[model samples]
Target: MALPENYDYFTREQWRNFHGKNQLNTVTGDELAQIAALNDRISLTDVQEIYVPLRHLIHVYLRRYHQLVEDKADFRGETVAPTPFLIGISGSVAVGKSTTARLLQLLLSRSLPNQKVQLITTDGFLYPNAELNRRGIMARKGFPESYDMEHLLTFLDQVKSYQPGIKVPRYSHQVYDVLPDSYDVIDRPDILIVEGINVLQLPTNQQIYVSDYFDFSIYVDAKAALVEEWYLQRFGVLLDTALQDPLNYYYPYAIGDRQAAFTMARQVWQDVNLKNLREYILPTRNRADLILHKTEHHVIDKIGLRKY
Candidate 1:
């Protein structure tokens, strides 16, 4: 199970061996089994092999963070401030980043009852459709340029400052636009999980990078071929279901011939998603605090934790 010397991340067998020795008391086998039953998307084997270990690792990190705060306060002779632990989750489209984010939020919250966990998607910071159309980057919706980086950074900075009742703008996928007056408030949570496709990518300038605000970051990694297949599958499912809704943003796409719809989805993946992943997302893998490397079946085969 030992990984190759040159490999920075764990292999599947290595992770299993590691987990065998450092099991946490927080979540039990029964609880994990129960949770697995709630979602058929991931198998029990994946949950035990990947997510259980991940949950334990996150708990360890949180424990260490609290200790560091205490140590710093004692050394500096000042009261320790309550700072939010920001964790960024980034991955390519259809790589299951959303699922990972949601699961982490659930696991982390259950690990410590007193700690508040908030999950925020970067979609809300995307520029309105009008702006994207005007900029002639409508086809580049998920690209880095499509987001309001300045506003996103500003919001993160305010969160770091422990600002009270901070409001975050909302984006509607149904309308594919930012809601003008709608917002959500972050009421000073202990941890914030910021999930997005390009969160790890550095800004061209120093002022507005999401990584600047992160306490820890994770990148979900898989081969481009696997992700492309998943993307196509998801598109097919959406075409069969959600696209049929009259109010669905992608209604027009759903009405197209199945073969035509599949072709269009592939083109979008190749031209836009894959391009952004290569130029922006994948390049930032080195910046992550941890990397979850997945197999062809979307099971996390190993974890790569950055050395201090």
Candidate 2:
């Protein structure tokens, strides 16, 4: 299917060529592995050819954003309030959104030596497992209804207000729960990246969509069937690696019947993740400032930037 209206579509080669021979991947193999998500492999060549241009484009946006804010402040005859440039990234479960977020965080931080860039995931804003159970939506974890939207909105509002020491809730992967009284403080970052499956979602409880805070946004795109395959592959890797810890949430699956484990994983994908992707996530793709379309092997094959 063709992309939504008002997009400037570019083949991967064409997009990479825009930067010409000046490109150089500054990150190392170790750094790539550090930022990469499970089952997502990105090479230094990909960084040099793909992400360098994208990073430069973001720099351009940031510059223009600062000027716009200054102009507004001058018009109002008020002191320019220091505000953050927020970027929202959204995508399916296994479409490699985390890796993209981490990669951008690292690249942006390195390039903008004077800027303090922070990356935050919306998983921390999810209702804790106990709350989910009480609400009878534990099975629907990761759905729009599963989040503490008010708390998230408050945090974002404070961040935009340049509120110093704004505390954000922290989620734990090993425990599979939101840690009680845990927070990651945000203190006046020049740029903030909010990446999540539902960052672009319009929640029923709020008048302001989360994307309303975003100066720029990205939607990672790929075929649903490919995402399912990627999700399963990631599950297997987690079983082999992360589940080795006795306290790991998926440890039971790692030690249980392998076929049954795979069955349960497949069931979760078909029932929860895929359903959320189609109903909540895919519909918001056209709202993104840029869409990165991935093909097999997790390679970004095309880029679609909104003209508006």
Candidate 3:
């Protein structure tokens, strides 16, 4: 199949076939069991095709990074210093980027013996909902301007510098806001996975894209139609569960009729999510170091690796 500009092609069947042939050989039974334990919610097929290769690529990058540091130390006649590997993972809302980020952190930590791995979501850097309302961008909550980009960049710089116990502000989904006086400290780690919806996008001024700080990046890809369905399904699940909490910002959504709630969710996807994906997210696919293309079932069907 001919792919359009900046796109790569792969069939769903090919991805399944690869998993069938390679799954058993890639990891020991004990290791596979551990991966299954970490990913109890995801299917075994997803674990084999998507998570396995994703973990392998991250391991390869980690190894290469250590080698480079050692080589630099030898050439400069200086002591070796440990540096954190920053990895960016971006995808649309409800595209499972959070789960992927968590899984990668778990797998990578386990892959290395006695190494610390940190996972930080860019959601924490979003402007408070009140701030979004004041800016008249409440409807554009997930857009780039809704984020505290300068602070996020500063945090990344701190991580790069291997600062000791850097405190990061925390955002709460239940309140749809960054909490007051809520912060977590990230002691230096061997790997840091920064996950978000638009982490790879270049700023309007073209000064510094979030991808600039990444040692490696992964873009999770799926058809727009599939993403729409997943978004609605996720909304339904949240409405039945999280949104039911009285303190939840989305509690009102849970009280609505099921069909009405679904409709509202779809409209949000069309007007907000889809618009951002087309205008900002999709355009950055070409900038990824690796792309994980998923099928309708949310299983990765193929991997597109950029020529390094």
Candidate 4:
């Protein structure tokens, strides 16, 4: 596939050089293990080469955002309100967006020790499995229509308005459903990182997009085939972990014939994930402020910074 025309792409080596002299080495091996997603690989070297420079860039953006807010407040003769800098991270399934979000959250928190940095996934905004089944779209679970975009938009609006104690619905991968009556509270944060496959999507019939609230947005990119391989690898890991818990969503597949399980996984990957990626996710790649392009084994080999 051809790269987008709107970005100035760089090799990982070149991208590593972009980090100024003020890079901090706060993340250790133990921390990386906790931050990484299942079956995801991220070395400290990768952190120093890729993420550190990215952190510096975010610092630059955050500084400018604060200045803009202060200038606007001065011009209007009003006090500057607590508006959190919002960062959106989007990618196809198994592309390691959660890892990126968590790592950035840690980096930003350490760098700005006095500021409160929070990370939330759009999985929480997904409609319950019961609702999807009732709507007869269970097969299209990850599709745009399966999500409650209105609720997500409302939450983003509230966060941007500096609303305190806002509740976000919780979703669980163990049961593959939105937990009933469970929520995560968002108390006024200084920086918020929202990560999900749908973060950059433009839903039909909606006047406003989720991206509209993002001060900085990233899209994780990889070839569909590579993503499929990673997805299946992750499935294997899930099966191994789920075997100990009967209530796990993959319990049945875990206890079933291994070959048959992989066969079904491939089918689902092609029908559901690949379809969603080609139609919805990939189209939004150019919409992000930056793109992290990955190669084999989840290695981020290239970085694409938007020209505008």
lDDT of 4 by residue, 72-93 (tens): 9999999998899999999999
Using TM-score as the measure, which candidate wins? 4
**Residue 277 C-alpha lDDT in model 2:** 90
Model 1, TM vs. native:
0.88
Select the stronger candidate by TM-score from 3 and 4: 4
- Tens digit of lDDT per residue, candidate 1, span 16-51? 655423544344556544543111146555655676
Candidate 4 deviant stretches above 4 angstroms: none
Cα lDDT over the full model 4: 0.94
Per-residue CA lDDT of model 3 for 1-308, tens digit only, reads 12224544445455445423443423444554553321123555566656665577677787898899899999999989878899999988777777777777766766675888998988888888878999999999888888888888888989988998988889887777899889878889878899998789875544898899999998888889988888777676667775549888678888767788788888899999999988888888878888877667676767776764
Listed per model in order, the count of residue pairs whose N, CA or C atoms clash below 3 Å is 0, 0, 0, 0
Q: Among these predicted structures, which one has the highest lDDT?
A: 4
Residue 116 of model 4: what lDDT?
A: 96
Window of ten residues with lowest summed lDDT in model 3: 32-41
TM, every model: 0.88, 0.97, 0.86, 0.98
List pairs with backbone clashes in candidate 2.
none
- The whole-model C-alpha lDDT of candidate 1 against the native structure comes to 0.79
